[model samples]
Target: MRKDWQNLAPAHGLNALVENGTIENLEVKDHVANILETNGVDLNDVEGVIWSHWHFDHTGDPSTFPSSTKLIVGPGFSEVFTPGYPADKNGHCLESDFAGRELQEIDFSGSDVTIGRFKAFDYFRDGSFYILDAPGHTIGHINALARTNASPNPGFIHLGGDSVHHAAEIRPSEYLPLPESIEPSPVPKLHSNACPGHIFAPVLKDGSKTEHILEWQDPWAEFVEPKFGLIYNEKDLRETVRKDEELDANRDIFTFIAHDWSLKGVVDEFPKSLNGWKNKGWKETTRWLYLRDFQAAVV
Candidate 1:
């Protein structure tokens, strides 16, 4: 997977490629279809492909999937993104992608189910999986919360699709404050095996005191500022992120954003079950990994 991702990395670099969208890029060798095939899953077995939004990155080459596979999307999707590129010249998706597939749009207004201030739909109608109305990044942006385990103690995994660009945007909250020390050292060259939390005080947001790192402060300004800015609605995005933070605070819930690069080699890849993440201590080990990017500020 890493090799495939490396192949997709723009030769001109991400920023440059973004600036010049017309540049011919390398072919994406690692499509979901290929991955499923590698895992012994047949293309015809895929029931549906749930799109978080209409973004080019999230919406892969849907043409690769069998026509029997349904294409599911959030509310307001068909009104804007349907008929795709050639039919709607300004559209970001291609007509071939939805050619013979059933395009289903989710409507949350009819469902009274609420999960942490966001309207939710029970996909299975059994409370095991939920599709959350998490708009802000785009017109029909959505998220998923899956019940990983069920018993006296339940564990959930929140698939926060583009809710925030990075984990720091919603972390270091009052519930999960930065620890006094971070193990596996975010910056191994600067610290031994464990990095002291106070070393990061210099990079804290303005008006955030050194003590705030150890104990989260009200008005919560300890997170790193997001670098990218293509947010459709900043206000609504902030609210969505705030609600995500509430879920992240819970130890039983493992929440991850789509673009958290820090989790690359840390977690188990596809074909391997992530159900044992809690027992493996993945959350604790990966919590402060993003701080490595702030090493220069502290130095």
Candidate 2:
């Protein structure tokens, strides 16, 4: 049987992705650990751990799993973490750290790994679920896609890993509150190239003898971060919406930024049985509710 699914990394650790500058929240880690414990699945038994990227939020609990488990990383997992473009102190881990664990390095030959012209990660052999590689939010950033059998058309549950932030950032009609300190002017043309977000970037022109480097707009810029609202400045959520619309056109692609408040119900409703969860009941301290009614909605 297929390994059961769990909210490995659920709950908004980062405060409000919209107004708060917190990129990731520690609380999310607590939630992830709690979810695992609630399901009665020992962290030591986790056979594999897939890290979409080296972002702190995603890699918060790298040490939690057993050293014997396999760890899967994206194309430049090692490069991005150590002596890479923009080195992050908390974002990556060295090979030596794993010791005896297996490491699966997926280097899509520099091509996007998703289905349909982009980086897509499929689970099992069914293609019902997938992970989309969408950098720019980070060097190796990716998004999760879940196609529920409930609908004839694709019913995608996009777990956006900072690729596209809150829905307000994508909603064209939403009025965003922009800080006056931050200008409304276009991001410098050269800035985008200097930054690593562009999937295609920094072109070299002229002859090899005297190479002249020129930068061009990335066609996939929309997928990175689009101009839809004030908060969407970092990512082109518009592109994400467009791509999501194209592939899962029925409009069932549910977009959930890591920190969205609405996720409380979704995470709570996540099948405990699938993850081997044994604990139940609401908590008065966190005001957390494990409503049977909500759990019944999973099917």
Candidate 3:
């Protein structure tokens, strides 16, 4: 995305949804820039930036940094979306986005390693970070898993970009089962220690109902608006659901999706290290909170 401070609307809002609906007064900032400034890091200090997918939200503004900043993307990105925008006449990428930069397209096929349910590629080759093939939300979608703490027993911080949007998609799975209890979070503006899990079932068009994982009393079953319109292919979506269930089951992995509204203000912001997520009990506090969105389903 070009940093056109002049017409800031396009940079922030999803123009594709304008006809159906959109929100005004929404301004998307260059988060990469925000992180750099907050940490007192220079632009040139950034070695590279990898995108989980080619979506507008994930791509952000690579042009804002120096021409030297390497732009890394998942496989098939160039073939699927090269000669961007005006050049391709039908592409979603902007030519200026990759102009004069060292573009690296990573291929995860034929990899020998598998972490959890994902085929993993060790980024640093030192066991610190990895790029996992995470398809579903889009073509060539990927995710990152970083070993944040590694003393007695290692813990991971998973950057789950667009893999799953809601707790419903990631909850009650075999790997990460619902916790028995949770501590209250200050951000939700609540002062408390204990909150229980909320699980619900969905009614079918035939008027029959399917049971939830544990049949815990639930006021909300997952009902994402179909109008929001996703572009996930069959194979990708299937793999996504399969692997997400695995990731959700694992206790050591802290997976953060691209647009998890439940995470906002609940977790630490940038410039604050999330390295201690395990010690702080972030997963416990935020896990069942998405059930709050089910309020509409409750009578």
Q: Which candidate gets the maximum lDDT versus the true structure?
A: 1
- State the lDDT of candidate 1 residue by residue for 1-299, as single tens digits: 11133322232133355456744564556777888899999999888888987655677767788999988898787876666766776555667668899998899989999888788999989989899988877777899999988876788889998877777777676566777888989999988799888787776655242212321122212331221224655677777877887888788888878988888898898899888888888888888898887789886
Write one digit per residue (lDDT tens) for candidate 3, span 1-299: 32343232332235634434554554555556665767898988887888888756677677777898898887777786677655666556777678899888877876777888788898778889888888766667888888988968678888887776665566655555444444452223332555443212321112222211221121212332211124345456656666866775577878787767877777898778898888888876677666556534432
| Model 3 regions more than 4 Å off | 1-13, 178-229
Off by over 4 Å in 2: 1-34, 42-45, 82-97, 110-117, 150-154, 173-249, 265-299
Error of 2 at 244 (Å): 4.4
Q: What is the lDDT of residue 183 in candidate 3?
A: 47
Report the Cα lDDT for candidate 3: 0.65
Clashing pairs in 1: none
Report, for every candidate in turn, its global Cα lDDT versus the true structure.
0.74, 0.42, 0.65
Stretches off by above 4 angstroms in model 1 are 1-27, 207-229
Query: Model 2, range 1-299, lDDT digits (tens) per residue?
Result: 00111222222112234236533323333545456767687877776766755544455454455687776665555554543212333322433334466776655555444554456756554767666755544455556676643534334555666554433333221121112221211132423212222211222122121221221134545543332112222343345444533442224454555644534643456434212111221111111111111222221
TM-scores of the candidates are 0.83, 0.50, 0.79
Q: What is the lDDT of residue 283 in candidate 3?
A: 78
Quickly count the clashes in candidate 2. 14
- Best-performing candidate as measured by TM-score: 1
Residue 69 alpha-carbon offset, candidate 1, angstroms: 1.4
Ranked by TM-score, the better of candidates 1 and 3 is: 1
Ranking the candidates on TM-score from highest down gives 1, 3, 2
